[model samples]
Target: MIREITEQAWSACALRLAVDEAALRAVAEVESSGSGFLPPPSQQPKVRFEGHVFHRLTGGRFDTTAPRLSYARWDRSKYAGSSLGEWQRLEAAVALDRDAALKSASWGAFQLMGFNHAMCGFPDVERFVQAHMAGGDAQLAAFASFVDRAVFLDPLRRHDWASFARAYNGPGYAANQYDRKLAHSYARHHVPGSGTKGTIV
Candidate 1:
């Protein structure tokens, strides 16, 4: 149904997380350019398949048959570089192992990994994918849950982009300049003198 997150949803998440709205917005922007779904007519949540994750989940079984969908290590060169292409790769892996394939991809605006479903308050990878497919509000809710469980609220509240990026994006965040991009996005979204304190919703 293409249920995108509304401004009210963002504000509610900010209040619940006790962080500035801009912080959440910045992460959303840097992670998925502030949208959860792919271009219209698809109604599919944005996704990025991680072949390394697929490899881990399947014990290298598909590594030989589906090298592009399952690799032992992260390889940017293998990426299709488009939402449609990524979905195609994900579907190919799904044909091999449905569970592992679903869990091997990052989903939605926050780009939360399916393996993190538990941390994000979902019972399983399928539930996680369902939530993401429900749209951005669900995606943001999952992101908030993850932030709380991962203890990223403090860093986000303090505008500690480096720490947030390192923890949220993993140790390889620096290679992608995620922290810098987050900081820049935050600056663009932050209102002067609004402070980083949580506002009453």
Candidate 2:
């Protein structure tokens, strides 16, 4: 899904948010390391599929059990370096319950959770999944929708990495230094004269 984005698509997404390209890219970098796909000045897109989500959705009915499930991420065990494990988990979970399965996994470069469909303005998770499958435009649109829902659009517009990071990544964002990372990523990507800067505070 995220792997299908073109360079123009990225610029257009940034334009939609009325943010500097660097700022948008910076957020994306911290979220998924630019998601392995950067477009024009090409960068590869890294795709992550989570199995823990499947375990939670199916109530441990599948290969892994509840006690073993880690909501923080899924690529820890069989999910590492391959999509097959997660795909199998997803297939089984979907057979048990479609909506639950969809709600279990995060999708695309931005890692938007299936449960966030409403926040992203999708009528349903199925619709969200459909759009996500269409590639970058839908994925970025979902991300923009979330930014609006979380009320971080203003912070992003101002390059307020701290505020945006807290809202986007949650209270534990500091543990990951998401704010600091945003600043550095922005500085690395933003034009020198753009007046953009990042801060942990």
Candidate 3:
């Protein structure tokens, strides 16, 4: 299901936080194309296995599943077991290892991982999942909290693509050109406003 926050709410929060609304818009554009959700539920959400995360969460118990230790491990497999897509793989992984499964998939428009609940100000993973299901408002709140927790606010505010992408998307951000995408998207959506960067619209 796709979820979207009210424009008023989005703007209000961005203005209140003195965040660059355009920069946040940039993140949304790249992360979910301006929505905190995938398209309607005709199909399941996309999911990719993070083998290294699987090993780390499982304490090397499933390391053989990957057969090596490298960040490339996250992309080595497109599915887990026989299941494909986010829901299926997530459920299958949950059956085997709940916490690890939650940590595996990125969620919402910001695509915050389930393991980030605490950092996003939620007490538990369940709460984090529920927030994504709740609405775009919750998702955006979580997104805001997430960037804050990851210390990407200033980076985003300054359009410091490298720092923002590195912290938000991990060390592999470059592989996806996350920083470049953010920069390009930011320019597309940026508007002159109250703060040093865009805040309106």
Q: How do the predictions measure up, each by TM-score?
A: 0.94, 0.71, 0.80
lDDT of 1 by residue, 30-80 (tens): 888888899887889999999999999999998887888888999999999
- Candidate no. 2 TM-score: 0.71
Candidate 2 accuracy as lDDT? 0.66
Q: Cα lDDT of all candidates, in order?
A: 0.87, 0.66, 0.69
Q: Write the per-residue lDDT of candidate 2 for residues 12-42, one digit (tens) a residue.
A: 7677777777787787767766653334343
User: Alpha-carbon error at 84 in model 3, in Å?
Assistant: 6.9
Which regions of candidate 3 deviate over 4 angstroms?
41-49, 62-72, 76-84, 192-201
What lDDT does candidate 3 reach at residue 99? Answer: 77
Query: CA shift at 166, candidate 2, in angstroms?
Result: 1.4
Q: What is the lDDT of residue 177 in candidate 3?
A: 97
Query: Model 2 clash pairs?
Result: 35-46, 36-44, 36-45, 36-46, 37-44, 37-45
Best of the candidates, lDDT: 1
* Global Cα RMSD, each model: 2.9, 5.6, 4.2
- Range of the 10 consecutive residues with the lowest summed lDDT in candidate 1: 192-201
Clashes of 2: 6
Those runs of model 2 whose alpha carbons end farther than 4 Å from true positions after fitting are: 1-4, 36-88, 194-201
* Candidates ranked, most accurate by TM-score first: 1, 3, 2
